[model samples]
Target: MNSELEALNSLIMTEADGLLYEKGLIRKLEKYGDVFISGSYFLQLMTWRDLDIYLASDKMNEETFFELGKEVSLCIKPAKMNYRNEFIGHTEHLPKGYYWGCYADFNTNAWKVDVWAISSKEFEQKQQEIEKLKFQINVVQRMAILKLKNSVYNHPLYRKKFFSVDIYNAVIEDNVNSEEKFKYWLQIKRGLSLN
Candidate 1:
């Protein structure tokens, strides 16, 4: 990998370990079921502008979930709170009581800290899919995926694509590198562009 990309990844990991975990959010969320840093940040891919932390729960209510978000914000002291409405339209499948919130301004660079409260079953299913993809893709292909993520998939100009999962699936389905797959993926995305 390149030095710049490595530095970005290092910056993110340091924040996750130092700020979130050390501040007791990771431990606090353990009551839910399992806690993880997932999405693009978990994959250690560049172009990830935020830290995505997921709390998988066997049971939780919408109110309780939102309450947890508020507590998290209080603990993290975010500059802004990103509510559920911001993420609702982007999720492909949302489980019962699923909540999305974010903490910003914790990092000096303005990187966001997004928290997702989800169901355990859904989390496991998604992990399986990622595992399957890992089994099929080679190291270079994975790097290609990261390059695509940083260059095109997560680019500010391409607000139509919210996250990297769709792009990852596209890479697998097309069995092609990031650049080639991006061209094909762009042709079929008919969803309303958030830009």
Candidate 2:
């Protein structure tokens, strides 16, 4: 691993630990269901202050989920929190579950935490997918992903038009090795013009 990338990952993980452990976020979450920390944080490719947490429970209903959200709000004291009932109105490319998008200031840095309450089946499937990616990503691909992720962190098309998954596919599957190639790949493959 590149020293710079490793250093950044370590720093971000430390902050994440502060949120998950020091703030009792994980403990608070465990009261509701089994907690699984996923996305860039779990993959150790973090380039920004974003956390994706999934709670798996068979008995999670709207009321219970709202209760969980209330607990999370009190715990994080977020500046803003947006709730989404994806189970009722499922969005394409998003998990079929209840979502709580929390934006807060932690350790003097703005952070975004996405908490999803999903079924155990869905959680297992997602974990399988992540594990596959973990095995497929070699050191070269890892560095490429880290660099591309950092470069596109502030792109106009980021999150809204493209996502980290697209970057991962580009680097891992299409062998996109640089920001230039990724931009070209986006244009040709996804019809997304980054320029």
Residue 189 miss distance in model 2 (angstroms): 1.7
TM-score of each: 0.75, 0.96
| Model 2 ranges off by over 4 Å | none
User: How well is each residue in 1-195 modelled by candidate 2, as lDDT tens digits?
Assistant: 378877988898899999999999999999998999999988999989999999998888999988998999999899999999998887888999999999989999999999999999999998889888888999999999999998899987799889999999999999998999999999999999988
* Deviation in Å, model 1, residue 173 alpha carbon: 3.9
Off by over 4 Å in 1: 85-96, 153-159, 178-181, 188-195
lDDT of 2: 0.92
Summarize candidate 1's per-residue lDDT along 127-173 as a digit string, tens digits: 77666766766666666676776676445646444446666766666
